[model samples]
Target chain A: MEPIIKVENFTFYYPDSQVPALAGINLTVQAGEFLGLTGPTGAGKTTLALALNGIIPNFQGGRMGGRVMVAGLDTAKTPCARLAGVIGSVFQDPEAQLVAEVVEDELAFGLENLAVPREEMRQRIGAALEMVGIASLRHRSLRELSGGQKQKVAIAAAVALRPRVLVLDEPTSELDPRGTLEIVALLQRLNRDYGITILLIEQKISVLAPRVPRLVCLNKGRIVADASPRQILAQEKLTTELGLEVPPVTALFRMLRRAGVYHGDLPLEVDEGQRELGRLLGSRASRA
Target chain B: MPGKSFLHKLNPLTKVVWSLAVITLAFVYQEPLPILSLWASVLAVALIGKVLREILPAIRGLIIFAAIFFLFQVFLIDEGQVVFTLVPGTGIGRITDVGLKACTMLALRMLAMTSTIPVLLATTPPKDMIVAFVEKLKVPYVYALMLVTSLRFIPTLQEELSLVIQAQRAWAYDLEGRNIIKRFLALIPLALPLLLMSVQRARTMAISMETRAFGAGPRTSLHTSTFQLLDIGVISSCLLLTAVLAVVSLR
Candidate 1:
């Protein structure tokens, strides 16, 4: 299948700054792919997220180089409204992304803009709310929510659009650990079950990189590492050297294997770690 | 939770229609009793709805306006028998009965005009009211939904602005300053950021609303707001009140 989004030599410079936010970056996001973007703050993670939705050239006045196409439509040519169905974007700040007071209405906002049939809109709102585990908050005001609940509602709003690719820009950074887990679980469900592509931009790779297979590391607005998590995590010097932290389990597995504790392969998730540990313990028991 | 208020149980459409009737009748009566009655009813509603708490602070703004209005009418109106002429022996001294009458009517009319609003705001959720308005009055659903969304966004923006103001003042922007002009000038410093932020919110909401196919056609109401028997009885009694007054006036 054709790539849903293609970025070729994309560079961006803010109006006030002399330096570019993104420097000649090239990337491709295909349908149904869960891609994790990792970098430190001010590393153009958000700038890259904006380019996928045509917000860079249209909303933010900035210097642009090369081409960014979303769902075969040129980001340069397609209006922001036109990109609604193709790219769903959630911002870093939940408050900035919220428009309606009520949860149901917030979910209905983008559907209303697309002029969807009213019943379908309601259905999508209901489905999205259910998907995000926020159906119980339908009547509550947006301001009444905790930061995590609000982010869930924000994600629900994006999912209601039913876009092929969903881009979340540090959606959980402002949230607590519990909130982070809730959002990551929901995102995993979306990517795994619904077959929706997800482009997640976040700094806390320990939380996200394990779930997504692909990882893109950025430094000074350039893609310094474009590889799977297993490959990327092996280069400990490159990771910490570039100010990025490797996932805890990956680091733990590397440490255990180095010390000859017992390891066949590096496990990414907790379950994977549990299974590996269970096998090692079983082998020791049998030998004894 | 359903709001606990006498007026809260009454339909918003009933309040709107009845208050409109009261407003129309307020114009015809020469007696202060009916005008006072209208004011009293509004206050009762406001009190029952717990809107009185909000009225105090929000209407600190309307006090100066009321005073200015009191002064303007106290001098400008020159009708009927004179009591205290504005000039005195020069022909404009003591206030006239007509002036006082006019002033009483004007003040009471203004008060009564806003009376229902507090009750409306205090008891009815803006979303429920908008849905009711659309369902009851045959307003196009899209427009009503837009209006509902706008009202929904209103409180969000207000809260955000108040927060921004407080945060700025906490950082020594002096938003708590009492000077009228300085406070007014202080608003200028905050307006741009608020507008920019609000616009961004609106754009996001618009997208969120559209992607679900929100306005493709006539949609079913997840909310059903119907007038209860009490609402009907209330509206009927208000209609009777207006009719009785009109009859009394004709006689």
Candidate 2:
């Protein structure tokens, strides 16, 4: 399977910043895989996501050193408009992306820009709205929505363009707990059911710990570790030193393993933790 | 329905076309009657659509401005019967017929222009206008997209500014002792916050537009607003009437 995006030594800097935000990073994301990008604040995760979408070289104008290939085209060579078809980016702030009063107009915006025909856009916009589970809000204005609903509408607009991969930069940072779960659940559905590739930058470990198959940890613009989500969670000392949160379930499992109460494969999610406990208690009950 | 207004039924394009015609007439014709009638027609349309309430503020601004102009012309310019003499001719006070004509032109033209705001703005949704601009004139879809986005945010920024002003007022305990300038000075902090927030929003909006597939090239729009038969007929008839009015005024 061909990798959808290949990043080699990507780095970026804002206009007045003394030091580069990111430096010398290499990574590749294959098709149909959920890739988790996690790091402490200022770890260059968001900057890396921006680089993936061609915002860095084209819009920001930093001294870029490496190549980023998305859907077989070099991001450096490709203009923002063309790269947009293959990589859909959702900014952390949904308020920034909403351009129209009505939800239908917002969804149609991306498609209109793509110059998709009117008939097809109607169908695609309808489908995308349904995918994010906000079809009922097709006529609601941006001002009337909660933050989470706004973000979902933003995501629906991104997905409506039919991009091969979706990139979100701390998408749930503005949402409440319930909103966060709703957005995460939608993303999971897109990955699992639609087979669209996903790249998300988040600081919350509970957000990425159980969902993504692969994780890349960054610190001070460098990739310190890249491995399976379970393996990355096991590196508690390193993660804590970097000021990142370890998910509650992952931490619980880590303690249980140390105490010899859990010996089988470590579970990353809450349901798995409950099942493991039930199995252990069941065995004990039988023995007694 | 018997109460349905004509302005509500008029196409947005027709409203714009007629408004432009009357605005153009303001510059050419020296007489006030045409403009007066134009004002009446606009008001009648607003009344029909129940959009009369929407145009009250603009009408208020125009009336105040016209009064100022009439007063200035009557007092300053020396024309017709000298209605009053105050400290005589450093040309301080005089009301001439020519001066009256000038005042009429200024006042009536101001009224003529504002008189149509309800017709163009209140009768149609701003989003549909933008969509029409794209679908009909083939103005690039991006321009229409931008127009709608900015329109969407107008109320948000207005509400934000309102809150800022209220917050500033709450901090001050005194109610009525300050002079007007002092009251105005208090607004500086509020205005600065609005300016700062708007700049931030602009930068973010620019980035957001790009990420959503707004390309530099020509593209079709997803919005679909069609011209009704009434739209076409209304616009054409307005154009013809304007042409006739121009010819008659010239003769």
Going through the candidates in the order shown, the clash numbers are 32, 3
Model 1 bad stretches (over 4 Å): A9-23, A56-83, A114-122, A233-242, A245-288, B1-14, B43-68, B71-98, B128-244
In candidate 1, position A104 carries an lDDT of 85
The alpha-carbon RMSD values of the candidates against the true structure, listed in the order shown, are 5.6, 4.1
**Model 2 lDDT tens row, A1-288:** 779989888766777787989988899889888888888888898788888888878887767687888999888788888888888888887777788878898888778777788899899989999888899999887788999999999889888888899999899998888888888888999989888899988777786788778888999999998998788777778878777687677788889889887787778788998998899899989999
Q: Report the Cα lDDT for residue A163, model 1.
A: 82
Worst ten-residue run, lDDT, model 2 chain B? B1-10
Cα displacement (Å) at residue B91, model 2: 8.5
Residues B1-251, model 1: lDDT tens digits: 25576677777798788778867777776677777787777777677666787776545545566667877878777677777754657775557788887787787777666666655666777767767887888888778767766766666678878888887877888765789988889888689888888787777655444433344454455456788999889889888978998888757
- Candidate 2 DockQ vs. native: 0.58
